[model samples]
Target: MNGWSNHLIVAPILVPLVACAILLVIDERRRVAKAMVSLASTIVLTAIAIILFAIESGPSGFEGVYLVGNWAAPFGIVLVLDGLSAMMLLLTALLAVASLVFSFARWHAVGAHFHSMFQVLLMGVNGAFLTGDLFNLFVFFEVMLAASYGLLLHGSGQLRVKAGLHYIAVNLVAALLFLIGVSLIYGTAGTLNMADLAARIPEMEPDRRMLMEAGAGILGVVFLIKAGMWPLCFWLPTAYSAASAPVAGIFAIMSKLGIYVILRLTMLLFVEGPSAGFGAQVLFYGGMATLIFGIIGVLASQALGRVAGYSVLVSSGTLLMVIGINDGAVSSGALLYLVSSTLTISAFFLLIELVERGQDAGANVLAVTMEAYGDAADEEVPEEQGVTMPGTMAVLGICFAACGILLSGLPPLSGFIAKFAMLSAMMGTGAIGVPPTAAIWSLIVLVILSGIAALISMTRAGIRTFWSSIEGTVPRVLVIEILPVMFLLGLTLALTVQAGPAMQYMDATIRTLSKPSLYIDAVRTAAPTGGDVKSSSSEVESN
Candidate 1:
């Protein structure tokens, strides 16, 4: 492979890091230059992401493992660009572009470091996805969380600050737990590289193996907290609701990062032996409980932001459940569901902000008049000249409807196609002697009910925003803001139209994920330079 192609893994992390650093030195007053640099960086990032995805999605077992500084594996930092990480990088780049464009409307000017902080956030997310070692993962996690803290509180508001603080505290605890777990695992297993750990575990002494298990258990809890699983997820809604529109939209992928880790680790580490799939039962029940709670939250939500938050929980919960199920078919379906849902909700959050802006002027006035006098007027008010509605509102309305359809798993969209794949995988096509397992039955029920609840929530929120007797003036929406939402929803539409090929890709990726041996062998023999191998306890050393 050519040098550039071989190093595709680092491109995602590097472009944003360099751009944002340059942004930091530029005076905040130079808005035009900053935007230009930021846009150009995102364009490059998208190209790099597409390239990496293409490389990983090629012939089976192909992965780009860049050992930093040309050092050998386990001893030096290595970046693994595989199908899963590449897919995440692509999704994140798309989100970054959309969020950055939307921020240009007004949010970008809210603070001095908005552009830099955004690029830093992308750098962290891409790093976390690309890192092949446990320690680097934690470092990347901290980076992402720190950037998020600033972004969440970018705009001046008491509620926003309060929510940001809460987010900070919760994640602080997760980080601490993350450190402890990593320390324990490194001590027990004697290496931080993921494949090395997998290779060592099977040969480790019993007591050390038990210690590793305990550490992994603690680490799993950290992922659960980040995933916003059930009781641990109380902070997600408030924080998401309080953040500015573009920030909240980008934050949609944050939780999915946790799900991605859990899926990766569980598949890689727990492939055989007594502890195979160790956390299956907990993830199964916990995931189901989370889905139930999310359904309740969606049904009871009063605001569109809160509804978006609960939808995140639902998405996280579904992936967790599918992981627990541990079947190739289920995993493939969940992967599709993951892509469509993230794009749908990211666009939805941005749409909510635009729709709410229009209601701000006349919302309270309409409310008080309705309570006191039964209506804005005893009779209908006639339309007046020069009161023409902004075409922007119509665009926002269409995007919102598309989001609703996607979120609720309605037909003629990728959402329905994804859910149908999952359901079909669970229950075969009318074989008299075949019967679904209890877990499959329960999952089927929860998935359907969650869709129904999402429908109800979106319907109520849409009606209140669009059909209420509010005499609000048309909101002055910007073309930049509307374009991002269209772009994201348009991606969702593309996924729908291309479901067949998408599902095939998903199936191939899942097959690879199911085979831990394939991953272990790839990593073990990955050193490009000649290396040494020791007795039963193997180590690779290169000159």
Candidate 2:
């Protein structure tokens, strides 16, 4: 929190923004140059994110709050980094590395400005996580969405174009809602700084508070739409399923962006005021419906891409449900689950294209037909033996199975550990003595059922793609292509092995988030590191 370390707080945003500008000047034909710049920038970001994560982890509470232009909070912009934002920054960086590396195999060259857009995306996502005010959050959100529009349509096809159009239209509306909400909240509170707003809400006049709540409610709708909550998620599956592999993989974290905002605002703005627990019921019921909808979508989906898309829904619903529970202990587990699911889904998105490369479009239909009726193979046919599996097929099969295990929340993976943590926290197993309520039990049932649904759907898809293909040909996958998938899955394995320390981190994170005063005080008291202006501003603010 001093000198250079303080500057690192803004490096995550500035690095990418500078890199994006550098990328914009490079010729489109210089693909390797562009890739190198993008990859180097992302790797540096990953390093900075790690350092920030460590700094926050070592601290007891909020520590990295940087005031912009030597101005005080409620007057100038600020960037705050605590356990939650640090973790998210690290997650986004990891995903960016994986996705960018995977794209270099071919996807990077398929469209113009892919590297530029990718860097812009990193800037936007990083900025969203770091910003200390709601208006800046909207600015970063729009930056993120604008970059995504190009990424979604990167490989320009009819399917991608159609999905991208729908994606753009929906998000544009969300952006508008975001603006109206911010305007109302500012109109009522006279400020947009989150910490200032949090401080004022408890003391606001009742009538103005009511208007603020209405604005917050509108903002919640916008977040839910981004989070892929049911009835507002009609566009997610199509848009996700149509993108190229790496783009889709990176896109996985975008949904969690919405979840991130919801968690932050709920903890900071509504934790202790008239707005306490505002929109909890809507989140609860909507999450339940979303879980059920995702289950149905997974079961009915024949395409692997669509299944991955629906799986995103399942992840979002579960997180929203956990938030609705409103327990800090439960939130710790939810954080673990969020990281595990995002990584798993990203790996799955990258793996899908490889697994289905050799299969015919009609293969799924034929497999279903065989399942409906009896297998067409003759009963007299002898079983084949000693037919050694090709190296490519074996590698793909292993990765695919790993994805299945993670997605289905099966044993011996981070996914299972995360869910178990949440369930245990829900059951009041450690230091928490409250019995499970009807709603908690219902969520428990849905969580288990969602796992089962995922298992069935993934198993079916796995068999059809790996076992029932008539071509029986291995895909022409390169080392660069498959390495990213394995690298991501490898991270999940690491998470599983380090669950003990990981949960400790989660526990500390929740402890910080559960106390709104920690965040509010950190932002409010953060002073600029300069000459007399900072001193004057600090003295005036104190008065």
TM-score for predicted model 2 compared with the true structure: 0.96
Q: What is the TM-score of each candidate against the true structure?
A: 0.94, 0.96
Q: RMSD in angstroms, candidate 2?
A: 2.1
Q: Candidate 2, clashing residue pairs?
A: none
Highest TM-score: which candidate? Answer: 2
For all candidates in order, the CA lDDT equals 0.86, 0.91
> 115-187 in candidate 1: lDDT tens per residue?
8989999999999999888999999999999999999999979999999999999999999999999999998
Flag regions of model 1 displaced more than 4 Å. 361-390, 429-432, 529-537, 540-543
Clashes of each: 0, 0
**Model 1 residue 106 lDDT?**
89
RMSD of each predicted structure: 3.0, 2.1
Tell me, by lDDT, which candidate is best: 2
